[model samples]
Each structure stands twice: as structure tokens, then as C-alpha cells.
Target: MLKHKCLDQCIACTACTVQCPVTAAAREFAGPKMVGPALERFRLFDQDIEISADYCTNCKNCDITCPSSVPVSLFSTLAKAQYRRQNGKSLRDWILVNGEMFARLASPVASFANITMNNAVVRTMLRAVGIADRPLPKYAEKNFYRQFAELKQQRFPDKVVFFPGCYIGYNDPRVGMDLVAILQASRYEVIVPDVVCCGTPAVANGYLELAEEKARRNLRELRRWAREGWPIVTCCTSCGLTLRQEYCELFRANGADEVASQHYDAGEFLLEMLEQGRLNSEFIPLAGKYLYHAPCHLRAQGIGLPSLELLQSIPGCEVNVADAGCCGIAGSYGFKKDKYDIAMKIGERLFTKIKDSQADMVVTECGTCRIQIEYATGVKAVHPVSLFKQALRFDWVG
Candidate 1:
């Protein structure tokens, strides 16, 4: 069912191949154009070759540069799922995909979990399981939902539910807090729902049934707000994309396609706010060279780099759009022991570019990319919203 859509549109001009930084960096590696179609061929004959799906970092550069408008990364993900199904899921897959379970289990003793993650023994175990040379994020003292519950109990004017994804909810509550502060400052009521996993990890790992179940749950929870004409805002690109696209798949299968069409990513939602003159900010001069790493999923959404647009609006900020491709942390792909070296190798070019640029900070919309970039560059990477929040705090633009 997931056949490559743009096969007929492809001119074989090699435009996509040439535009891909991944292919350019790794000459032996097949770019998305070839890989996507090749998977179709492999699937046709029911061949079980792995096709090195783990090699793709899912940066969406191929999609961004493709002239024929192919959904390169989406198809590549589908192909990865195919390969994962044949080769069997890795230990790292089990760890990353069952993130919700781990979060819930760790919530009771979150401090212990946080300490354990930072421990040398635990780091070795993590490396043994597949993650290498990446620092794990510390778990929050309090989860996002708990923090949201406290805020919601108090009175507010306009309410907007915040979907901070699993990482922000559990690992980095600062992001959630910052988002709440921003929404409150904008005079909007912020609600934190008792949300479950967004099912992106499941979908990526080929657990389609599990993903669909989670999607249905999320839809039922958000449908009321949708009916009320309120927007569901998420800070993570994967969560936003899952809400915008995968939830639609659930509706299409259940004969409710129209409702699925209304989901919005944070960038799309923010751009809408900007156009409507609902969002305004005081520019804070952030002195430093800033590079924007567009996440693969964000690029796949075809939003025309709204994150960079938002960043550049702040005066005295030098934003560099990196020619560097994926950071090679394609969710759980780069964390596996077998794929760790390859992931590092793939990420080296981007890391080197960022280091060479001598940027003050790297900003991106995807939480995973932030993690990967920070791990690779040792430069603090943050969400664009955080910078925007900082800009709003300034007294004067000049």
C-alpha cells in the first residue's frame, strides 16, 4: 500500500541524488530517490534484504530538494519499516519504541532514573544496547501533565492544550514550562491533557496496530477541542506530524477523512498566528552565529522553514541555514550498537560543519534533532519557541 508515489513524476534528472547531502557525504550510500524506488522493487519480489535502512538519518533534505515533489523521507520510513519487519526489531528499537512504558515506570522514582541514566555503568549498558557517546537527557522532577494540572486548576481566559511529546513531558519540563509561559503571555489559556504517547515511535518501528490504537485514543481526546475550534499546539515536530498525518490515516480508515484534515503543526499554527497579527514579540538581541537544522519530518511537512523565519525576525541574530544534512540520529536508528559507528560517520560531516561555523547555538523544531545536534556539536541546541520566548522578554527591540 505504501508504494512510491512520485515514480511516474521522476525525470531521472538525478536532481534529488545531487541535492542530498547524505549521498554527497557518503558516496557509497544510495540516496532517497534510489532507495525509495528500490524498496518498491524489493517489496514486489518479497525479498528480505535489509537495504541498510538504518543509514538514512531522515533529515528530509531529499524531500526539500526534489523537483518532482516526492515524499522521500516518508517513503524512506515506510521502506525502513519493511526492512525492520524482515530483519527483526533491534534491542534499541524495543527501548525507544516502548518509551511510554519506561516513562511511566520511571515517574515514581524519576530522580533515581535520572541518576541512573547519568551513571557510568548505565551509560555502558546503554552503549551495549546500541547508544554510543550521547548524553541522556535528565528526567524532570515533575512530569508535564502534573505541572499542567496545577496551572489549569487556576482561572484563565483562553485555553489552549499543550502537547509537549514524550521527551519534553518527561525529560525536559523546561520546554513545557517555557511554552506555557509563552501562551499565557499571549493571553491564551494553556491546558495540559492526560495524553499518552503520540505513536510516532510505534509507526516508525512497524507496529502499525499499536500506533493506530494510540492515534484513535489521541483523536478521541482532542476531537472535543477540535469541535470547539481550539487548536492543539505541540512543540515537537514528530508529534505535530503524527497528529497532522497519521491521525488522518486513522480517520480515513474509519470513514471520517474530513475531520483528520484539520490538524496543524506548531510552525503552521505559528505562521497562521503571525499572519493574523495575533502573535507579536519584542526582539532581544542574541549575539552569536545561529544555524538552523531543519528536521526531516518538519521539511517533509513542506512548511518552507517557518522556524528560521521566526528566528530571523529577532534583530541581531545571524541565522545560517546549514548545508549539513542529517545528524544521523534517525530516532532509534543511530542508537543501536551495530549501527552506532555508521550513524556517527554519517553525522560527522554535519557536526564538522556546525563546529566550523563557530555558531553560538543551534536551533531546530524536532526534539530528537536537538538531542542529536547537541550530542554531535557540544553546542547547546534549543527549540525555536524557546528563543522566541526569550525575545519576547526583552524590553526594547533596539
Candidate 2:
């Protein structure tokens, strides 16, 4: 189905080929334009080779730059599904694809689990499971749901539910905390929802049934919030995109469309607040420069540089946009051992750009991008919510 749709529109024009940052940086790797449609043909004819589908970071650059508006990322994902169906799933695939199960199973004694994960023996185990040499995030001592449950109850002018996704809820609760603080400062009643996985990782690994199950569960939960007139607010770009686009596709044949239409990212929601004059803060002078790496999913949503507008609103802050494209850390793509070298090589251009910028900090909306850029550049990368939360302190309501 991915290939049936007009290959002629491509003209083999190679606009996408040239625009691809990954192809330009990693000479060994074939560009998305070539790989996407080629894999579709590969699925048609020769289905024996278990070619590594993990190489693609799912950066969406090829789709973004394509003149034909070909959904290269979508095509690649579908092709991966076809490939995996023939080759069979790996043990590592089972672990990564069912990441929600691992997280829930580890939740009761998260600290112990965290300790074990950090241990040398466990690190080696993880390496055996295909994770690279990168350090894993420790589980928070207190999860986001528990923390939000304790917040003082206050009725506000507008209400919205927060879906912190699995990563922020368990690993980095501070992102959710800071997001709540910013929303409360803007006079919105933030409702913290009990949400599980968004299943982006599962879909990427070709676990369609598992991904569908997770999507249905999340859709029911989100639909309840929608019925209560609360828009689903998300901090993670991947989660937002999954809820907005992919979930709808999962239910498209079944004719359940409304489940996927109810999500918004913090940046898009903040931009709306700015437009509506609901968010007001005194621009505090914070003398520093920042380089912003826009996440692929965020760009896919068609909201351009709202993060830049928010950052620039901070007085005395100079925001330098990174010309370098995808950070090459597409969720857990860079964390796998086999792909780590290619991921680093693909990200080298972005790394060089950040080094040359001499910026004080790197800012991005996506948590994974923050981690990757920080790992690659050795610069403190923070979420835009943190900066806005800092600025909110200056605007004390009498």
C-alpha cells in the first residue's frame, strides 16, 4: 500500500535525497528516498534478507523535504512491519516493544530496579539485550501521578488534563512538574491523567497488535477526558504525534476517528494561550544564548518555531536556531548497540553546529532530543517549559 501510491511523482528528482541530513552525514547509509520505496519493492520480490530496520532513526527529514509529499517515514515503518513478519521478532524486540510491561513490572520497587539497572552486571545484561553504552535514566523516587495527586486543589478559569507519557511520568517527573507549574501560573486547572504507554516504540518495532492494544487503552482514557471538556496536553512530541495521527490510523478501518483528534503538545497549547492572551509573564533578562533542535514529530505537526517564540519572549535571551536537522536519536534508536555508531555519525553535523554556536544552553521540546544533544555536545539541554517556569516566578499574582 505504501508503494502503490505514485512513485512517478518522485521523478527520482532527489530533492529529498539532497535535503536529508542523515544521508549527507553518513555516506554508508542509503538516503530515505531510496530506502523507503526500495524496501517496499524488496517486500514484494525478495523477502528473505533480514536487513536491519533499526538503522532508520525515523527523523522524518525525508518526508519533510520531499517534493512529492511522500510519507517516507510511514512507508519505512510499514516496510519494517513487512520485513519483521518474514524474519521473526527478536528477544530484544520483545523487550523494547513491550516496554510498558517492563515499566509496570518495575514500578513497585522502582528504586531497586533502578539500582540493578545501574549495576555493572545489569548494564552488561542490557548490552546483551542490544542497548549501547549510553546511561539509562533512573526511575523517579516519586512518580508524577503521586506528586500531582498531592498538589493543592484549586478551581481555575480553564481546565486541561496532562498526559506525561511513560518516560516523563517515571524517569523524569520534573518535566511534568514544571509543565504543571507553568499551566497553573497561566490560571489553568491542570488535571493529571493516569496514562500508560503511547506505543510509538512498539509500532516502530513492528508490533502492530501490541501497539493497537495500547492505543485503544489510551484512547478510552483520553476520550473520557474529552467528554469532560479537557483537551489532552502532552509534553512529549512522540506521544502527542501518536495520539494525534497514528492512533487515528489504527482505528481508521474500524471507523473510530474521534479518539485520535484530542491531543495537543505543550508548545502548540502554549502558542494558543499566547494568542488568546491567557499566558502573561514579565520577560526577565536572562543573559545567555541557546541553540534549539526542533524534534521531527514536532515539525510533522506543522507548528513552526513556537518554541523559538516562547524562548525569544524571555528578555535578554538570544535564541540561535540550529541549521542542522534531526539529532539522529529517534526515541530509543540511538540507544541500541548496532545503530549507536550510525546514530552518532548521523548526528555529527548537528554536534559540530552546536559546538560552533558557543551557546550557553541547548533547548528542545522533546525529552529524547534533550538527552541526545546533551550527550553529544556536553552542554546542558533543558525543556522550554523549565525556562517558562523560571520566568513565571517573576510574575507573582498579588
Candidate 3:
């Protein structure tokens, strides 16, 4: 639906404004309902575009909070793309949008690049180009796709396809490896297909055309796997949201609805397995209470807190839900130097909650969220899948 069409659903509710984290963090940001659906009402009359739309992190907080089911973030993103096309974009936009290309380039210099990017000179240059000064996620020695080929697992008749998003594939292949270990434990053959980067960062950065192209490729792969009776799963919350909802909501990619229906967040998939009495309930005890921060995108899926619930179920574990809100690193929003302050301010609650709790460590499903947590709070953060594999002492991979 167009912005005009979505505007008709609103009855002037202020709920979105009240719940908007960006608005709370950066006072200048016109909160969701106004900059999003409300501004669309003006666009219906062919008015000028909304400049405030660019400030939206596209976190879908408005969509999640809307009582009227308005696609609030869609309007903002569409407007953003339209504005970008008219005014052109920055070089940083090009780099940030093509997440896969950047990951590939960084892979070759993985170790040195990680060390180099931490310096004042590099950070000064990055800030000039709109990138933040903070330490970015380091590229892994090998991406998940390359690492997948190197792992030897016990094969089984049952099969499942795993979509290792750019973050998991490039920054943290261990999480991907952990999921593989757990799947092998469940006696299922893991299939790693040629899926694109879900194009979430692309869409968020206003590269709508590139995002659609990436989505089309992923859709084709997802359809093929679905046809062969392979259930698709993902560990990254943003990637899963892009595959399962954003493609349809933002880009309107062909066959996206079907692909979305066949998708599952990895933790949610495991919870389903638990309910079905098929999960491998082996013994190994993790002796401490861990804090679990649910990413906004995962909550936007409306699937409840699967990772937190699953962690709590472990006999030797206690999972404490963080007393916080959004982590503020919504895709690449926080990576821009201009927006870094807002992201940090928005995340202060979460960082404080982590410090106050003083849990042994922090765990979250989103890779960016994990990075933000570790960067801000100096607490070791990881994907629950990694924790699961380590706690269970799964011998296949660490």
C-alpha cells in the first residue's frame, strides 16, 4: 500500500510518539506517528517530502506499538528512499548499504583492519564520512559460508536450511557453527544455501533498488529450499525480520509472503522443537545467571521471547530479562557519526541495566545488539546459540 493508503488507518493515536525511542533520545526527531503516518497525510496532497523521515532508525517500534496496524516504518522508509533519489546519497551510504561487499573486502585484512580501525586518525576520517568513531565489529578469519564447507558433521535424513546473515557470516562465524552443532545434535542435516544479505542495511540506508535485487535473489533461494522440505532458520534478528517481514512490507518483493511464511528465527525454531519433544536435552551445566536482551526486531516478530524462555528452561541456568529498551544500533543507524549520540543515549538504559544487574554475561540474538552491548558496557555478549553449544560442551565445534 502507498503512504496515502496507510494513512487512512490512523485515528490520530499518540501511542507511537510516546513509545518512540529515538524521540526519547534525540528531542529533535519528529517521532514515528508524525514523521511517518502523519506526514503521509500531507504527502497524499502531493506536499513536499518529510526531512525528519531520515532520522527514523526503521526499528519498527511504531509498527509494533500501533494499535491500528499501520505500517508506520514503511512510510518513513519509502519517503527516505524517495528523498535520497532526488537529492543523491553520500559515499558512506554506498559502503554501508552493500554489507556483503564491505564484509568481503574486510575479510582479507581481518586481523589488521580490526586493530587499525580503532585508532584516532582512522576514526577522525570515518567521522568525516558519517561513519562513527566507535570500534566497529571486526571481520572474522573466515565467513560462515566458507567455514560451513570446512566443517564435518554427522549426516542425517532430516534437513534444515540456515541463513547466516552478514553479521553471523562475517563477524561471528562461531554462532553459525553453534547452530550447526545443535542441529547435528538434533539429528538433522544442515544445508547452507547461497542466500544474500537480506538487504536490511540497504533498505535502512535508502538503497531501495539494491535492497530489492538482494531480496529477489534470497527469495529465489528460499523458495527452492522450501520446495525441498527444508525449514529455513536464521540467528540474526534483523536478517530474519528482513527475510520474514521487511521484504514484503518495504520492497513488496514477489513471492516474499510465501518465503516469510516459511521462515523462523533460530531460537524460535528450537523452542518449537522443544515443544515437539524432539530437542536433544543432553547434560552439561552453566553455573550462573545470565542477562538476556531481546532485540526490538525479534520482539517485532510477535513470537514472544524464545531465546530467553529457552535459556531459563536449562536446569543449571537462570536468565534475567534486561530492564531496558532498544539497543539503538538499528541496522547501520548507529554507525553514522551524526547519529551515534542518539544511539548511545537511547541505549543508556540497556547499558545501565546490564551494569546494575552484574550478571556473569549478556546474551542477545541480534549481532549488532551484541556488539553494541559489548562496546558500551564492556560485558561479554553472545548469541544464545553460542552459549548453548558452550554450556552443553558440544564436541563438534566451539
Tens digits of lDDT, candidate 2, 1-398: 53567454565777767876657656655777667665556656765254544456666677777778777766567667767777688887787666667776777688898888889998889899888888776677887777777877557868888889888877778889887877777778888765679888887777777788788777766777776667788888888878877777544423125544556788778878877878855555777888888888888777686877877777778888896778887787777787788778777888999999999998888877888888888998888877766755444331
What candidate 1 gets wrong by more than 4 Å, as runs, is 1-11, 19-31, 48-50, 83-87, 152-158, 249-260, 280-289, 394-398
Prediction RMSDs, each to the true structure: 3.8, 2.8, 1.7
How does residue 312 of candidate 3 score in lDDT? 75
The weakest ten consecutive residues by lDDT in model 2 span: 250-259
Worst 10 residues of 1 by lDDT: 250-259
List residue ranges in candidate 2 displaced over 4 A.
1-3, 6-9, 25-29, 41-52, 227-229, 250-260, 394-398
Extract clashing residue pairs from model 3.
none
Q: Give a tens-digit lDDT track for model 3, residues 285-360.
A: 7788799999999989999999887787677887899959899988799898889999999999999999999898
lDDT of 1 by residue, 1-398 (tens): 43435565666667777766557656556777777664656656776365644456555667677787766666566677777766677777778788888987897789999888879988888877776656666677898777766764434566776777898888777777777776665566776666689888877666666777777777777777767767788888888777766566433434124334555566666666666767645556877788888877776666678868877877888999986667777666566666566667777878998899888898888887788788877899988887777766622211
Sorted by TM-score (best first), the order is: 3, 2, 1
Task: After the best TM-score superposition of candidate 1, give how far the Cα of residue 221 lies from its true spot, in angstroms.
Answer: 1.8
Candidate 3: lDDT of 174? 89
